[model samples]
Target: MSQHSSVAGASRPVKEAGFFTKIKNVACLKSSSSSDKGKGGKGKSKSLSNKVSHGFHLVEGQSGHKMEDYHVAEYRKRKNHTLGLFAIFDGHLGDRVPTYLKDNLFNNILEEPNFWKDPEAAIRSAYSSTDKFILDNSMQLGPGGSTAVTAIVIDGKDLWVANIGDSRAVVCERGSANQITVDHEPHAERRRIEKQGGFVTTLPGDVPRVNGQLAVARAFGDQSLKAHLSSEPDVRHVPIDSTIDFVILASDGLWKVSC
Candidate 1:
């Protein structure tokens, strides 16, 4: 249980989006035990009691977009107590912004004193605070922007998930897949963007995009669009009792090919 420290904001150079153009295949690692069932199954239990195993892999496509820009962190404080997170961070101009977020965002969320008791509020607070921190420190990070989608697994039974931008997470249950993240396309997020004084555009055969520069209406970094592009993440809670088998968290490139 580490606390998050606020960092000073600064401006830096931006990276190119070419690194994210590659396609990749990812597989979920099977766990040895079912999180839904307990030692004796003696009725409902509370306080994060369960066991689960998780795994994932990534491969880059020929588009020169290396798969390294994405960031993932898994921390288990103790046996059966864990946190798993995934973020796609599509960089329009450079990778510094996404890389910085990958390194700091989750730590900031977990370090909040309220997270243990109220995961949702803590997640929301962290999302906004982190975004502000990024904007405040834009000068240090340089130019560029990144989208984030993160899932926190606690006690193997309770899951707190959040996302800002187009990155996504999906749950697999009973041999079927259900999308848990909402794609914040310009069309879908039009009203929100308009309220924030932003605009959207669409090309033939393509979904609406924000200002024709990005598909997601919100994301981290992109200081130039901060007024319209938000870093607020949509948060959800999933219980272990539900028919949950596994989950997949991916970037746009993977989604482009798979979906």
Candidate 2:
């Protein structure tokens, strides 16, 4: 089955969220009990439980900085357990913030003693703590921020998705698409920003922005705007069984072009 979901452009009236919470949920693209024919050959059959493929590209924006990274890995926690992790980070103003998250965010969540018990709460806490870490290390990370979307697959059966900022995640089941995350746009977040003692503004031909600088209302880093912005992520869990076929995670660039 094939499914497609278009992420909205920045102009869309969607709430913005980021810090891209990384949580644990497991999903498999194919049923483990079935021997499916490989797409690459007529007779080959591959184990769907462990089959994964990924690729990425880098292109410098007009500002001359190239800062986007995606990650997919099987993370081992205990002697007998492992989790599939996927994430995408879109950097603005600098790359340090996203790079730092790509390296540390998941590790922090995995370290939580109760991660497996209450994954939702664990993810929320991890996102907040991760943002605090960014704020505390502003001196080294610089005054920048990133949008993120992450997925954690546990036991290859449950899929947990989370995000902050405009990045997104989608799941395809029975040839239909379902969005699994909410986009945090400035317009939708204005009230929250104001209540937090920060403000949002919309200039000519520009989408609403927090403090008239950053485009996303939620993100990791951006120390200058951290007080008004949020790093909390919207998270969801879906069981990867016979019905669900695949998942998609991408940055605003792809969303803008197609969503």
Task: Give the C-alpha lDDT of model 1.
Answer: 0.59
The CA lDDT at 127 in model 2 is 87
lDDT for each residue of candidate 1 in 3-102, tens digit (9 for 90 to 100):
1110100001122122221111113322221121111111111122234434433444555443324445344464335554544454556667777776
Q: Which stretches of candidate 1 lie over 4 Å from their true place?
A: 1-50, 66-68, 78-81
Scored by CA lDDT, what does every candidate get? 0.59, 0.63
Model 2 TM-score relative to the real fold: 0.76
- The 10-residue segment of model 2 with minimum total lDDT is 1-10
TM-scores for all predictions:
0.75, 0.76
lDDT of 1 at 248: 59
The Cα error of candidate 1 at residue 107, in Å, is 0.8
